[model samples]
Target: MAGFFKRIRAGLNTTIGFYLLVVVLFWLKTYLTYRTDFTLGVSGGMQQFLLLVNPIPSALLLFGIALYFRGKLAYWLMLIIDFLQSTWIFANILYYREFSDFLSLGIIKGTGNVQNNLGKSFLEILRPGDFIVYLDIVILILLLLFKVIKIDKRPFKFRYAFSITILSFLLMFAEYSAANANRSGLLTRTFDNNYIVKYLGLNEYAAFNVYQTQKESSTRSKAKAADLKSVQSFIKKNQVSPNVSYFGKEKGKNVFIIHLESFQQFLIDYKVDGKEVTPNINKFYHNQHTIAFDNFYHQVAQGKTSDAEMMLENSLYGLPQGSAMVSYGSSNTFQAAPSLLHQAGGYTSAAFHGDVPTFWNRNNTYKSWGYDYFFSDSYYKNKPNYNVGYGMKDKIFFDQTIPYLQQLPQPFYAKMITLTNHYPYELDKANTDFPATQTGDSTVDPYVQTAHYLDQAFGEFQQYLEKSGLAKNSVVVLYGDHYGISNNHRPAIAKLLGKKSVNKYDLAQFQKVPFMINGSNLDGHIDHIYGGEIDVLPTLLHLLGIKNDNTIQFGHDLLSSENRQIVPFRNGDFVSSQFVKSGNTIYDSSTGKELDLDNRQKKLLDEQQRFVNDSLSNSDKVVYGDLLRFHKLKGYQNVNKKDYDYTKKHALKQLQQSDRKHQTSLVDQNGGKSTVPDFKTNAPELK
Candidate 1:
């Protein structure tokens, strides 16, 4: 037994063993920071067993230290391990805070999909000072231990160390087994961080628990029946239907809804190299029925692209903080676009994207959204590939969509999302298919080239519409999905545009995208109104002579003659007109101006908070249930579009009263004594 013990000690003292130990410790730190304990409950027996064993790599290092201590070597390796671990922990802490803030404000829910350049930019803004502070703490501890601890007399016995290591390894294995007990079953106890606290230390477990609880609570509250009911009541009592008196005077129009991917308005620049980079878009903006929404902002959550799409199409609430596309897609209960349109106006709806329908679970969501047909990668053949993983070129997507447009029955709604302008925008060198127009050594220049290509494609699609005889009747609306995140090109873009620095908010022009409605029958006029992707649905419905009886829409029609209120969801807050922006000064909406700014700002902020809370907490009830009940009561088939006129007037009157009441109450709640003067209570007469 003595000989065997000695041999084991000798084996562990090898250089390879020391490196392995370090590697194990590094991996454990990563797992602890990134991997939520929630998985322990989801997996069946074998998977749980594996997860429990996942901590073995972390535990082994403590034992390996004694066995492989060549004093100096051990010290350096430990230092390196500590440094890496500290960095990872610090990064995670920042990410967690940002994610939590975003969730609290309803900007995003808490799925950790920060893949875009804008995502990186947001991360950069996330507490850099806090990260530095934590890093300093780690350094201080390391210094104190290295200088003060006397290691010469410290006990380093092989048997004792081995025993502890074995014990830890066994414990980890047991934990893994517990995690894998049942894959499909709701193993809440095992998965919950609060439960894990029974074994893990309080600090580690608490960090995860706080995050999880908030997320779960938020999601449940949003999807709750009571909340949905409130929204429905509010809508039924407020929303006004547009009169169709002018419908026959105006020609039947073509509507083009372009959902741009990660576009931000901050990216729009008038000149580059003394030449306009986006001249066509600028011209369109100047000439068309353009509504320049300056205050419009994107509240991207975990499933960034999908969340934007959902908010725009369905006006449905977002997922719980932690639940994103991967998890949300697994369920079929979420509200959707097509169903609402079909119910409201009998408009034939279709969805189009330039990728696999399965990506982001759009296939499932689109089907649920009530789209009669969906065009995806499967819909096209013999198309030139963009050489990226997602799908074919945007040009192809647009070109192919033309055929489908011609065939779709009249009074149809088509949603087209393009993709060629996606990140890593390099023209393929190997394929001779799409000839390169511009070439440069810098990586970012390719993205510019790609953007140019996308612009050209847009122009081509417009030409196709005109030639195919669809221009006179169709209405085309285009906008970006989110801001592009490629960091390589930011500096170049800034330099080209003559900007000081390029950040997420500054890239708002990219998010600004192009939202224009052009049809031969439509007048060429510009409407500089603040709006967002969420408003698109209501606006379109209104334009099509469709009345929205659903109470869940948080958005109002941009064309409506009401006082425009634009609210952009950012991380855990909102950017509104009330938010004062001056020369580089970002203020909390309330005190954004020099203390003397209108007290109404405070009321605005409070109103926004109430709006978000009410919207989130009662989404399903407000959006679907109340509307459905109302429709059912009146008889869905029996009531024609004319029936909504009285409801519209009544709802509009109630909404105005409610808005005033909310404003007054919110201001009072915020400790402000200011009172809003009551406006005329008379409702607008429908033509």
Candidate 2:
């Protein structure tokens, strides 16, 4: 035992042994960060193994280059490279803690303001646990400084160094193969950053992001007007004629788009222990003035809420891999609803949400969309206990929003995003008297309580709007952003839905989301329309009396008799009035059974599939190629993003100036009195 200890200690003193030590330390740091700090969403043993091995090649490749040098220079280079890699991991750790996202290459190269982006001070970014990253480095430095270790002067042959570098490249390719085999399209159809970081190391993910960004920039530079020719032709050929009766029904009215987070359609009148889940929204669905769609689905994938927003505003499909909103929204040219209504009609547009402006890259995207103002989390008090899931509780959010709503210029296009009903549905007891589902799944139970709380908040806000008189003048539209219960919790979902099992077709049906629109003097009926998030823009455009004949929108007005009810989801699968295509097997939409199709029916299905594929491909071309920049619209101009700013100070100034100039604000109409006191919430956080 004594001899073994001596030999081990002696070997560690050598330069090669020290290099190996650095590699092992880097690997440990990365794996530990994956397990402890960051959530790359490791699912099973395969994913765990992938995460375990992905860090090996980067650590080897980075430190192995130092082996080509000799003596102190080699050791110093290895140490510096190790430190820089650690710094990057540390930055992502701090960033992931706040945004639940890795630091983008844009953020890394653009600013030194980490504190500003994370909403943390310099010291707050550094937690006590973070010191673990530097512990190994500190120990090595101390050993060298105290003369406990001597610099090694051994000659590392060229063949050995070359072999190490080559081994790294080979191992990296092997890792990519394993990742793709585990999950096909792991790289090509990249969905979440977490998947990339999990399958490949953080260093590899960073490299891929740089490559993607450069590729997109090059594509944009090479874009031309001719690229939009096919897209324009397809859109014009398939345009739906508007219904004369419904056209201009809500023209010149204030447009209110309520973004309901993680809300699904089944929750309407869904009972938990004989209590309603979303009673208020249910009531509004049956309201005399509300046109509700029972078959509306939210077509979202990796982008989720951001994807829904992209389709809602632009009438364009989100990218298949990642969110177009975060990937291209800042730079892409959008003929969006906000700008169309603002330019074509004399309307002011604003978006209100209790989250950070940087969430979904909305701060820049909103500017590109020609929004007059964006009211983000900084505008609200956001006091302690006020934030639950993503941002401020919905009740508190709506209450805080009333003041801003009153201040916006009248006939405004306002979108308020609610956050209380988000996933991992947690809530303080005071805010919800509704009991959670007794199911064993922790993530699936509290959903009802949070959803019920949102319903209460919506009810309170609607009544307040009525009392404040904004309800009478505004076209209030509310829609669920996406599904709260994912497919993984199928057993629990089946039990709640009183189903023996939820098969693939049933799961496809589960994608249905709630969509409704209401306005004064509108004899609203339940429209049995098969539509998705894509159809929202054209439908709203027609109602608002905005002409879009020359535009390149892919969606049709839901009210139009000629609307092709072919709703393509983010994935290749699509839903239609007659059938639901899950993978390759088409199921009868009503019965959820495989279709025994005749010859003509098969031909029709094939043609429908082709249309869906082309729609997705053309949308991708328009986005990646940025085809809109070259095409000119008659009355439209590119949004001067420089004209808009969403900071607290500038937003306030902009609102006040617009109000002074127009004198048509709600506050101005209400005799210069604020409507803040009218709205109330039972949120115990407020108490």
Candidate 3:
């Protein structure tokens, strides 16, 4: 026993013990600083201290055991374990949804300070004060004490090395199992069974079990096909095609649609530095027949960027529940805005983005959307690489589009998606044309500078339009795709603002992005209609003097007096809407609200539900390839007068036959049973 004690003591005096002590102390210091952000009362303090200290004891026990048995091999093994654990933890935290939200701390209530401080580069913010210097020193001292005083005399051992290798393998296996368990649960909840199995790699046995359960549940509660058919019939009967005046008449007009990357409304506010940050956009807003939707909101689902694009162009609702862009990309049949316009008005359309077309499977989606051509980073020539984080410079993007515009036929629709304002706002020095100012952090300054530069680029584009004589005959629309939130200077931002709020939603202004429309031929007056990205296509169609069947649109035109209000829906529920008529009653999905069904309210609700069902069903079909193949559906030619008479009769006969067969099939399927539940009697009033 005495000799054993002597051996343990000797091991503690080795370099292995020294490094383990250093790491533990460092972790402890970091945890302490983390806890200081919140003031813990006595009991809370004790709990926190214990929580933080428990890891130390556990680590020490493992380290001590390894050191006593393994010697030199144990030390190297411990280092490897520490590295793996730290890397995993950091990756987990970084990728977690909540991490990007730290940018909201700097936003003032009234000022539109939408500039994200989160997107700055690592080196730009790397400085002496960037780390907790005092805590670091304390950790160093603890490490030195363990190394020099306690663990300097230990010798190497083969047995200890073997023990560490086995332990490390076990530890890694355990960690991986825990991570996989959580991921599996998350995937099952979010995605369909087939999707989970194919894209998420769920084992066949587990996936089959989930599939069987879902299938049984669906069978028991599924709406009858007959009832769905009746609902569709009702919608078709009540559906009125909008006789929009501005749609097809404005021929030979160039249409420019700029989808700004993360340009939120909060960023539109003039800063205190006497410089107008978004001057170009503000100027365009004032000079055009603009409608600034103060209550505009985005319904960002899984594919935040692509969702915005789909909603804006196609007037489609947000992505279906549990749709990850990666998985959804594999499916090729999603209907969208450009295709509809192409079919209706013979408008030549092209889509451009400054990133790789394949980034979000946009190349496929765009091709499916009837875009005559798609331009991306590869499309541009002699372009300066702007390390603006995401892609080519917005300035160069606009410049490249100019030649294309001049060469294209009249009355073309060009969609330009900018990238200079993407996250990690710090523009690579190679990308920026402006001189960087000292803003304590090099990255933050570049972001602000990039915004200024983007504003300039927009102005130049506008000038180009005017110079080319297309300004007077062009319709221009601009909006942000999503908000940026990826910077490391969040702590500093919180300190600068004297508040500690995190996440963009916590800040009301982060959701607001500028949506504006300008056209010289149109009236120069502002419309205060509430709208969102979903309304953009309908509104644009209205402005272009092009009227479609309108039965397909879930969104209303801003210019239409019949439905002037916009109702924003997000996450399987309505967020806000002027069109939703309520009688001193609030309808919330989370907190049940008893929907008081007054006559008007009932009518509106019924209409909305019908619209929702049709849209959802059709959109689902479109996305899943049950509808026409997106790529093949293009190149539709309109019949001339001589052929129109014959074609019209044939079309009418086919439509009638199709409708009759569809109804008969529904009747056979459901025995003519109504699936519409009696809302007044069956469902409880949502409070």
User: Which segments of candidate 1 are over 4 A away from where they belong?
Assistant: 1-224, 233-254, 266-269, 288-295, 320-326, 333-335, 382-386, 429-445, 486-497, 501-511, 580-600, 620-687
lDDT measured at residue 564 in model 2 versus the true structure, 0 to 100: 80
Local error of candidate 2 at residue 71 (angstroms): 15
Kindly list the per-residue Cα lDDT of model 1 for residues 344-444, writing each as its tens digit: 54555667776666666665555545566677666566434432424566665665565445444455577888765665454454322232223232434
For model 3, the superposed segments whose C-alpha errors exceed 4 Å read 1-89, 97-252, 318-326, 383-387, 428-446, 485-506, 548-551, 564-574, 577-687
Candidate 2 stretches greater than 4 Å from native: 1-214, 596-598
Whole-model lDDT values for every prediction: 0.48, 0.83, 0.50
| C-alpha positional error of residue 642 in candidate 2 after TM-score superposition, expressed in Å | 1.4
> Highest lDDT among the candidates is held by which one?
2
Q: Write the per-residue lDDT of candidate 3 for residues 1-687, one digit (tens) a residue.
A: 999977765655666545555456545643553343212121334343333432343344344454544444655555555544344323222322222311111111101221223234333333443244244444444554566434343564657645655665554344334434533442323232222222222122233444533443353234333433443344355333444455554544667888878776655654525566678887777774654554565655535676788778766654443232333333434445555565665555677776665666665556556566666656566433442566767776676656444544445688888877765575655444555434465444455567766787788787766655666767788787765543234543343234574322223234556787777666555555556676777677766666534234456666666663535444222333423322223353223344556788667666664454454544443443323232233344321212211122453354345435544321223344322221111101111
TM-score ranking from best to worst?
2, 1, 3
What TM-score, over all chains together, does every model reach? 0.59, 0.76, 0.57
**In terms of TM-score, how similar is model 3 to the real structure?**
0.57
**Candidate RMSDs in order:** 17.3, 6.1, 16.5
Candidate order by lDDT, highest to lowest? 2, 3, 1
